[model samples]
Structures are given as structure tokens and as C-alpha cells.
Target: MSEIWFRTGEATVFASEGQATDAMPEVVIGSVKGPVGTAFASMLGQTVGHTRMFILRDCNQQVRPAAIMTSKATITNSAYVGLLGGVVQAALADAIVDAVANGVIPKDIVNDIAMIVTVWLDPRTAKDENLDQKELYKNNYEAMTTALTRAMNQEPTIDELIANRKTIRHYSLEGLDIE
Candidate 1:
């Protein structure tokens, strides 16, 4: 006769070698005619050595899939800085493209303006710790106004505009977080 093992909860079931099913007491219940009964009956003939089956009865029961944890590789400072540079460049390019497309800036000087802006606002440069979007936009607007005025009065090189760019800083009347 085939051996049968029953388990419940988190308990372990131990069975002796060459165990017979006749040693266990018969368990009888009313006919189970639902999907669960069908699945259980189908599983009885297919179970092999040390097979495990879970039957969840409670509607509130939750089963979480097991996960294997792995260690992530370390990144060097130079590599991290490189990634930041790429991100900054992409953001600057996108902003320049949007500005030109929206007619905020002239299309003819977009590349030159982009270059000057990139040099002036390098991500590697030190910035105020508390600077936020409003402060950054304000500073940029001020810088652009100054550059445009200079260009209108007298033609200044890109280097001059870069040198005349405004510094970004946080300024608020009431104490509050910007983000």
C-alpha cells in the first residue's frame, strides 16, 4: 500500500521508512462536490516523493511568493558623476529644444544659448543646498533678461553671457518646504 502523510500549518510531518497507509485511522466527511474537492481528488494520484501541496481555505489568507535577495554591485564616484553629467546634459538639451519650439528663445541662437547655458549651469558646479524650482527659475529669468539687454545694447560673446549668469539661491519669506 502507498504511504500517506498529512500536514497542517507550519508543522513538520515525519514518516518511517516502508510505512503503510493501513496504520492511519480513516477520516470520513460528507461529499465534497466543489472545485476544491475536484482539485484534491485529481492531486491524490499524481503526488510523488516529498511533494508539497497547499490548500488555502480562508478568504482572508494571503500567500506571498518567496524572493531571493542578492547584493548589488558598487559604483565608483567617477561612474556616478558620469551618469549625473549625462542626465544633466539630456535635461538641458530638452529644455533648450522646448524653449526654441515654444518661441521662448530664438531658433537661430538656440545652439549657442544652449552651449552657454550648459557651461554656466554645469551639474558638477557647486549650488546652494536649499535651491528649489522657483528660485532656479527666478535666477534663470534674471540671467536671461540681463543677457538679452546686453545683446540688444551691444553684441556680447557667449563667454560674456556665461560670465554674467546669475547665481541660484533659495529665498523665502515664510518657512516652508518647496517640494
Candidate 2:
């Protein structure tokens, strides 16, 4: 086997001693750069929901036919958790794609997503019984808020928080929040 040398902005040349042989063609991998919108649209268009079924099935398998036998409510709750996880994953993926398309930096995507989930899980803005079903909403609210504050390096102002709350409520009641 002969070694190949690469030079930047220069054509690859074979050394006298290192002649190219009839081997498999070299596979060169290159970075792709393009319009963020196109890339995001392509990613979001792919089949991303197939894991939901697997997750639900795993949950069912774990909770069913135990020696002691699981209650119907226990099984139901397990299914709900799996379903909810899938939903949240899908929602976050969509949000991230949109954010990237809109020029959000890759480094800041996590914080942006944290802020988004915080708003979605805020009890003050939660609509219907989603937030009323136990303290899940409250717990998520506290955790996400803390994460957002830490990421921001400072606590968000009251007006800013209220605006986010209102925006989320409007988004739930009306279609997308217009702001």
C-alpha cells in the first residue's frame, strides 16, 4: 500500500516511489454548507417518529405480566410516559430545526431550547388539564427556569417572563404565537 499526501489549495501529486495502484477509489468526505432553511427542512422532513411505537411497546412489556401483576392504572401511566416522551422529543426537534433555519447559532441552541421548553411547561401558561395533572408541570417549570437562568447568566426580568407566559398561552389557545 502507498501513502497519499494532501496539500491545501494544491493539486494532489504522486511521488515517483508512490505510484497510484488499481485499488478502490478513495472516498473523500467533505463538509456541506448551504442555506440553513433548506438543511433544516430536509431534516425535519425525514421519518422521525418511528421510535414512538418501540418506546410504547417497551413500556408495555416492562409493566405487563409481572409475578405480582401490574394494575391497569400502572400500565396506563407507563404508556402515557412513553407517549409523552415521544411527543416532547418531536416538538423539540421541530423547534430546533426552525431555530437553526432562523440563524440561531449552534452553540446557543440548547439554551434556546431550554427557554422554549420552560415556556411550554410553565404552569402559569399551561392550558386545560395538562398542567393540573399532579405536580409534573410545576416540577418541570422549576427545573427549566433554573436551567434557563443559569444559561443566561442572570434571571430574566419579570416583564420578560410575563411576556413569554402570555405568548405561550396565546400559542396554545390560538395557533402559533404571533410575536
TM-score of each: 0.24, 0.23
Q: What is the lDDT, from 0 to 100, of the residue 102 in candidate 2?
A: 41
Q: How would you encode candidate 1's per-residue C-alpha lDDT over 100-165 as one tens digit per residue?
A: 465544555322211112112323222324324333333333443333333323434557667765
RMSD of candidate 1 to the truth, in angstroms, is 33.7
- Which residue ranges in model 1 land beyond 4 Å of their true spot? 1-76, 111-114, 118-179
In terms of TM-score, how similar is model 1 to the real structure?
0.24
Clash counts for all predictions: 0, 0
Please state the error at residue 152 of candidate 1 in Å.
11
| lDDT of candidate 2 over 34-144, digit per residue (tens) | 232233233333143221211111334321101010111122233444323443223333323333344432333322121112112211212323332323323332332
